[model samples]
Target: MQEILNLEPQNIWKNFYDLNQVPRPSKKEEKVIKFMMDFGKKLNLETIKDSVGNVIIKKPASAGMEDRKTIVLQSHLDMVCQKNNDVQFDFDTQGIEMYVDTDGFVKAKGTTLGADNGIGVATIMTVLESQDMVHPPIEALFTIDEETGMTGAIGLDETILQGEILLNLDTEEDDELTMGCAGGLDVTATKSYSVENLSGDFKSLKVDIKGLKGGHSGGDIHLGLGNSNKILGRFLHESLNFNAQISSMNSGSLRNAIPREGHFVISTPTANFDELKSALENLKKDILIEFQNVEPNIQISVSDVELATNVASQDETKNLAFALMTAYNGVYRMSPEIAGLTETSNNVANVVVGDGEMKILCLTRSALDSNKKNLSETLKATFELCGFEVSFSGGYPGWRPNTNSEILRLMEKLYKEMFGEEPKISATHGGLECGIIGGHYPNLDMVSFGPNIFGAHSPDERVEIKSVQKFWKFFVDVLKNTPKK
Candidate 1:
């Protein structure tokens, strides 16, 4: 990690190193909040914290640039905490051990390097402390809990901010300016089942599916990646030919993460046990062929396990399996206005059976209100027909793009002048805090851009080394070129 401290952009890297010393996982950002507060107070800036733990620090403009309008630099404080299964580090007590790789990427050792928003936060902090920066008044807004629920963005008081121009530094691409993002909501369906004693004449087995590349449910939904729940559902649906009964089912842990692994316990009559094994082998082959390109590491294994006393009835098991097999699990539509953009999609995120109840959670997203509603309602109706109680929660709005805004025009001009190339203007399918924040501050002109980052929200997350230096230069140039109030 010493190599990171010696990177070209000392200001940003210094602050980012400090951030790595604090644990700030989603919903648990107290330590990082205190760090920000102390850092602001040390700089003699007017720092305040909102009821929901959002921090706003005000810095006066440099001597000759007071006439420029105040710009709000925003980034969330929390990161998605994901570590390799074999790693024993605890997120609550330990900080992420980030390292500079030989490939010129900043990554953590067996964990997610909080560079998603950490870099953004560090850049804002560096700008706040710089005395030579020729900028207007600045409001550094640090939000909380963005990874899981977006509690900070949703609950923030818009009145606390005095800026009408907001710059969100949370996007992943370095050469792209994100103008808009999709709105999203979580949908969950539940059903009850009765278990009966398993006959001694039946054999039990546990089927495990592993090694799939489960990515972001929203950003990677259109990538044709395999969903573990859906894959297991298909296997179960076909395996029913051998009269296997499901004892219990579980898949995926987070709703926002596409499932990478799944497990199902099953019971088959002793008479057909051999046939059931043969059938599962054939089904595995078919699944492997189907996802051969995208999910090359896909693995399916069946192991003998001790029999359980109770298992779901054949009818109940079959119904659940078929329901999962038919559920919507990928991009449903593409944007007509923007070429190659996803307009609507669904992620069949998680499924679990426990305590006589089975729950299935799916997430839906769209840029248009009507499309979001229509897709969500369609999912609800479809699952209801499967005899499961369905409900929606945590709906957030989408950020509407302002193509003719003065800030965007200025940023574009400066970017081209500095880099000798035009930045790509685009919209993302994933949920961004800009949407929720924009909903509250209707007059604010917002745009998001950042350095290059890859494999976010997973253990493979990494930040590009050269992109950080380029992003820092662009950021400083923007500050020196802010338009007059």
Candidate 2:
């Protein structure tokens, strides 16, 4: 606990340390919610928990500031539970293993640091507990299950909130002020085919692509990072030119991340085995050079395996490969309205090979509802054109930017005053609770801002300690100078 206070501004880091001590993975945030509720009661703030487990704590305005406009500070209570395969920790039972890295980044050992939204929660908690801080009436909204889905935000009652302005603390970059975000849907494609025994003499080989840094498909899409599944599909697409047969394919685990590594089993005639190996070696070099700056260590390997009789027919294999190759992944369109902003993107997150059919799951995103629908339809059409069945679900709407927002102007002015510089206002590629919150609270004015966080949804995730200080200062300033109605 002493180590916690050593970070900065003392109380904020203490609350952040306390948060790290709780196990609050997405959809499993009961203990954390109870803790927050208890803390709210101790502070004499009005606390309420809805039926779906979302918590809201209300703090009255500071002395002489009671008549100022009300404001809501929002952040998700749950974190994405991901860790290295070798690390043994249950998100359902154990707290995250926290440590201060040499780079002054706070991280979790072999697991995601949860800084994506944890820092946001801590910042709000710190403000809530501060007795000397002057501000308008404040509502701290802690939502549940934001990582897996926007369930808590979706189910929240609009009437519960008195604030017409909302400040979301879930963006990653420190200086950038996010004005909007992309909506998204998940697509699952399934097909069934007959497996037949191979009659020809063939050699079994496992083809692997690994060592790529796969980040969020939406945030890191334009970076030209490698997608192992797409790379594998390309390899197979080219191998088919040499008459190679695939046995099984698997890649990526989550629906929102780009695949870092993938492997597929292929059966080739004994005479073509050497040709396949040579082709893989050449392709590996080409890929390494092509993605040299982004994925330097990308490797494509071919090794022998026991020949299996149960394999998809050649036509089925070709169709699957074609679908994967043609299916949309990464940025589909840039916002014509906002320069250099991604308007839509897709993440082909999972591919599983079954007995008869191969299943590919994709997650698509867009800030515009029409764009989201169009991209989803385009992806479905691509699969249909490739002769596979496609279905989409888990769709959510985007939060449109309100340029005439009074709260936005207030925060912008406060940010400039606090930092002596203008904040970078822009939209985010990833979804946030603001979108769903807006659906329920149509009059709510929303804008999101946060400290510098990197590698969200991955084991390498970390939050900049210094940026947290600035973020807290700016947040306090916004509350202190909120506009009067």
Candidate 3:
């Protein structure tokens, strides 16, 4: 962590280290809120904490820049808490353990680095402490619960912020400016079944689908990565030929992340055990071949386990597996306007089977409201047709691009002047708070850009060290050149 402080932008890394010391998982930001409040008070900045735990700290303009328009440096306080299954770390009780790799990427030990928005938050803090830097009156607006839900943005008081320009620091790419993002909603389906007694002699086994590269549901959806929930469904659907009855099952914990692993406990008649094993092996071979390049480590295995007295009824198990298999889990539509951009997608995020009940959760996203609704309806219809009760929640809107805006023009010009090459202009399939905030402030001019980050929302998350320095230079320059209103 000390090494991170020694980086080119000392203040940014220092503040990031401070953030890492506190737990700030989505919907669990009390400690980080206190930390932010104390930070603002120590700096003598005017700080306000909203009813929803959103923090806003204001600083006046530097000399000769008092006439410049107020600018908002916006980022979220919460991070997606994901870690390796074998690592025994509790997000609520432990701070992130970060280290720098030999390749100059900053990463956490067997856990997500929280750089998705931690770096963004740190950048805001550094700018607030900048006494020698030229800038407009700045408002560092840090929202809460962005990863799991947009609660902070939804509950934010619009009147609190006087800034016309908002610079979102949550994007992942260094050379790209994000002007728009997809809106999203979570769909959950549930089914009830009777727990039946094991009446016949049966063999029990635990089947696990593991070792897949699960990542951000929206950002990595276009990569065609393997989803563990879908793969588990496929295996179960295939095993039905051997007359297997599921006892219980569980998979992926978060709705916004693509499920990387799934576990299923099942039983079959002793007569069909050999056939089930052979069929499972064949299915594993086929799945490995299907995702060989992108998910080389994909593992599917079944191990013997003690039999439970009760199990899900055969009909219920079949319905759940079939439903999961038929559900959408990848890129749905490509943007006709932009090459290689995903217009809409779905992630079959999680599944859990327990006493007399089975649940499946999915998240869908699209830039267009009509498309978003269509996707949601499509998911609902699919699940409904499969004999499950479905519902949607935590829906958020998408941000629209303003290509002719003053902020975009200034940033584009300054970025090119600084780097001698034009930065790529595009939108993301992932959800950003810009859309929700923009909904409240209708005339807000917004653009989101950040340093290079990879594998967000997963334990493999890392940030490029060199890109942070470059991003800092561009950020300060952009603030220095904020046009007078």
Candidate 4:
């Protein structure tokens, strides 16, 4: 813990350590809210906690920078809580336990490091309390529940902030400035199915799917990684030849993360058990070859399991399996304007089957609102055709790009002057708070940039140490050069 506090730019790292000591999962940010409030009050800054749980701390400009326009430093408070299945820790009860690795990365022990927005929050805190830094008047806006939904930004009071420009510190890449981001919609499909008695003649097998690199549904959706929900569907679809019936299924968990593993219990007649084994082997080989380049560690296996007294009825079983196989998954469209940019995508995030009921959850993202609706409708139609009731919620607009804006030009010039390499001008596929906040403050100039953080929204999340130092240097300079009012 002392070593982490001793890292370069001690102010930022120490604040980060202090922030992570509170249990701050998405939609459960009471402790962190109190922490931020106390930090602001203790520093003698004017802090306001809005009704929606967002925290705002204001600091006046320094001597030479008082003529510059005010700007908002924004980051989310909640993090996506994910851990290895073997790790036994409670997110609602414990703070993240992180360590600096020998390979120049800071990571958590078998859990997500919460660097998605924790570093940004810490950097804002440092600037707010700094007496030596030259910067414009700052309004530090710490939003809530960004990972689960943009409810904080969505429900914010429009009159609270007086800033003319907004700086979002949530993007992952260090050398990239994010000018726009896609909107998101949560698509859920659910239904109840009938159950039937399992006969004594049925032999059961547990099909396990594991080892896929599941990541952020929007940021990593273009990577073409394997989805466990879809993979389980494939295995079940293949089992039709053996007359297998589903007894229970549990795959994936979060609506924002790509599912990495699945556990399903299925039963077939004893007469067909021998033939099922051979067929399973063939299917596994084909799946491996299909994803060999990206998912070399993909594992699929079947083992004996005790039979349950009941299973999904034959008709319901076939309907669910076929729907899972036919449903939309992965990137739907690529941006014709930008090379290698995903325009629209979907993640079959989770699927749970048990207790004679099933629910399917998916996340859809796109920079265009019409395209967003189109993809979502297409998914709704697919599930509806399979006898499931579908609905869409938590819709947020995308941030439109302003390429010729003052902030973009200023940051681009500063980045090249400092790094000797032109920073990449790009937009993120991930859902950023910029879009929602921009909707309320229509005239505010906005751009998002941050240090290098990778594998966000997953347990493999890590942050680059060297990149943080470089980002800090550039950040302070940007504040120092804010446009004059």
Candidate 5:
């Protein structure tokens, strides 16, 4: 903790330490709401907590900068709650245990370091309390539920914000100034089937797939990382040839994260159990050889387990396995307009089957509205043909890139002057609140930039220390350079 406090940018890290102490998981942010409210009041700023739990703190311009345009600095309050499965910490009650990694990154112990947006929030807090920092009139917006549904940004009352420019500090790469981001749709598939009684001669076997490098489904989807759900589903689908009957299965958790672990229990007649086990073992070897470079630590283990009383219906099991194996994942398409940008993609993030019921969740993303619907239709057809009811909800439009943006021009010029090189102007595949917030305030010129944050939406999340120092200086300068009204 002291090491973090000693960083070059003391204010950002110190405020980050204090902010991390309060639990701020998505969908459950009551405590954080209060924490932010208290923070604003303690600074004696004009703080207002909206009816929908968004916090806005207004600060007057410093020195002679009152003629500059009003700027709204924004960051989400809630973070993606993910952890190593073996870790015993409860996100709901315990503060994240953070440490400085041997490698130049600050990370949390077996949990996500909330640096994805926490650093932005802390930056805003520091600016709000600063006595001498040059800036225009500032409205600091700390939104909630960004990691999950982005409901706070969606539902924010439009009447509050009076800013002409919004600087969103939520992008991952420090050098990349994001003018756009892909929208997202949540796809849920569900069905229930009858379970048949296990025969007396049946034997139980447990299978596990672990150690794959799961990551942010949006940012890392193009990396070709393994999805545990896809891995287990492929195995079970292949095992069906040997007449294996699934008793229970579970894989992944959050819809927006790539799955790292998968587990299932199945049974087969004792007469041919050996043959099925041998085939599975051989397939594991093939899998290891197939993904040797990417998934060196990936393990596919099988062991004996206590016999289960019921097995999922054979027909239903076949359908479920088929759907999982056929479900499209990974980079669906790259942008034609922007070279090297992913235009559309899907993550088969979660699957569960047991107790005569099965559920699957997928998050699909695309910058083009038509492509988004088309991809969702393709997935819907795939699952529906397999006898599952698919539904879409929690949809949010992507932020369209505005090449002629005034704020973008100002930042581009400022960045070149400050760093001696032009910043990368790109649109992210990940979801950001700028689109939603912009919808409410059409005239607001928005852009997002942040320090380097890697492995977001997963337990491996970390942020670079040096980049925070660099980003802080640039952030302050942007405020100092706000255009005259």
Candidate 6:
């Protein structure tokens, strides 16, 4: 920890190191919230906690800066909890095991590092406590459950915050300033059928797809990373011609991440088992080459299993496979306005099979409300066409960008002055609290920026050390130089 403190990016990295010592997975952020509130109390700042566990701490302007503008610094307290199957760590009771990588990136051991917004939380806390620092009147807002949902931001009252300018510290790229983000919704599809007994001599086998780099659906959607569930579904669909019958299938854990692994159980006639194995080998070779650069180590394996007493009818199984393959996943459309931006995408995140019913959960996102609605309808139509019941929920609106925003102009100038180059201004494909916060405070000016983070929402997530230092310096400069109208 002391070595981490000695790193060049002093303030936020030190705070991040301390934050990693606590457990704050989504929907389980009480301890982290209490820790923050207590720190505010100790500093004699005016801190308030909402009924939904959101915290806001107000710090008066430093001496001679009392006449400056008021700004809100915001981030979520909870992190997306993820870990490798072999790593046993409880999200509710255990802290993360963090270490510095040989490449100078800080990451958690086989788990998510929580740098997405934890860095934001720590930066605000450090800025508030730094007596030697000079800045404007500040409000640090920490919301809860940003991973599972934006419940804390949705429940926030506008009257609680008087700041007219908001700076979101959850963006992933250090060189880009995110002015807007996509809105998203969750879709659940279910299908049920009676089971039929298998005939003739049969060999049971387990098929798996693993070792792909799964990432945030919105941020990494265009990267062409393999979704394990989609890949496995395609393989099983093609292999069904070998007279394979699926007993059960399961894949992926989180709705917001592309699945890295999947498993399924299937049975085939004992006589044709050798032929089926040969086909699997061919398929593996083809897919491995197809995804060589993006998903190297992507593997498909088969093993023996106890044959199920009954399995879905051949027609039902075929329908399930077809639906899985046809259901839209990955980039749906590119932004017409912003060249090279993904305006819409979907992730086939979770699949479960039990008791004659198969449930498929998907998440869809789009920066335009109309586009989001159209995409949802398109998916719902697909599910209904396949004789499945479909439902949608948890939809949220997008944050529309304000090109003439005073804060945007101020930050743009401050960034150019500090770095001697214009920051890349962009809109993210993923959802953010800015959408909800904008709705609550209709007149507030907002923009998001952060250090370079890779593989977010997955076990491979990490933050760059040098990027944090640059982001921190720019953040401090913005606070000191930006003026009110």
Q: For candidate 3, lDDT tens digit of each residue in 1-485? A: 77878877889999999999999999999999999999999999999999899999999999999999999999999999988888999999899999889998999999999998999999999988877999999999999999987999999997999999999999999999999999999889998888998987899888898888899999999998988888889888987887788998999989999998889998889999888988888888888899999998888887889986678877777888889888988999999987888999999998999898899988899999898889889889988887899999999999988888789888999999999999999999999999999999988899999999999999999999999999999999999999898
Q: Report, for all candidates in order, the number of backbone clashes.
A: 0, 1, 0, 0, 0, 0
lDDT of all predictions: 0.88, 0.84, 0.91, 0.91, 0.91, 0.86
lDDT of 3 at 301: 86
Consecutive 10-residue window with the lowest summed lDDT within model 5: 308-317
Clashing pairs in 4: none
Better of 1 and 5 by TM-score: 5
- Taking the tens digit of each residue's C-alpha lDDT, what string does model 6 give over 1-485? 77678887687778888887888988889899998899899999999998889999999888877887788999999999888777888988887788888897988899988998888888898898898888889989999988777899998977899987899999999989889999999989999888778877888777888888888989999999999888878777876888777778889977898898888887778887888878877887888899999887677776667876577766777777887889999999999999889999889999877579888999999998888888888888988887889999888788888899888888888889889999988999988999998899988889999999998999999989888888888988888775844
Instruction: Give me the runs in candidate 5 sitting further than 4 Å from their true place.
Output: none
Please give each candidate's TM-score.
0.96, 0.93, 0.99, 0.98, 0.99, 0.96
lDDT of 1 by residue, 1-485 (tens): 67888997988998998998899988889999999999999999999999999999999999998899889999999988777656899999898898899999999998879998999999999989997888889999999988778889999996999897999999898998899999999899998989778757888888888777776777788899988899889778876887888888888767777888888988889888888888888888888999999889888897789875577778878878878977888998999999988999998988997557889998889999898899889888878887889999988888888898888889999999999999989899988999899888888888899999887877778999999999989988998888898
Candidate 5 residues 195-257, lDDT tens each?
Answer: 899757988788899888898999999988889999898789877987788899999989989
lDDT of 3: 0.91
Task: List the candidate 6 regions with Cα displacement exceeding 4 Å.
Answer: 195-200
Compose the digit string of candidate 2's lDDT tens values, residues 81-181.
77765689898888787888788888889888888788899888988988899988999999998877788998897789989789899999888888888
Instruction: Report lDDT (Cα) of residue 107, candidate 1.
Output: 93
Instruction: Estimate the TM-score for candidate 1.
Output: 0.96
**Which segments of model 4 are wrong by more than 4 Å?**
none
Span of 10 residues, lowest total lDDT, candidate 6: 308-317
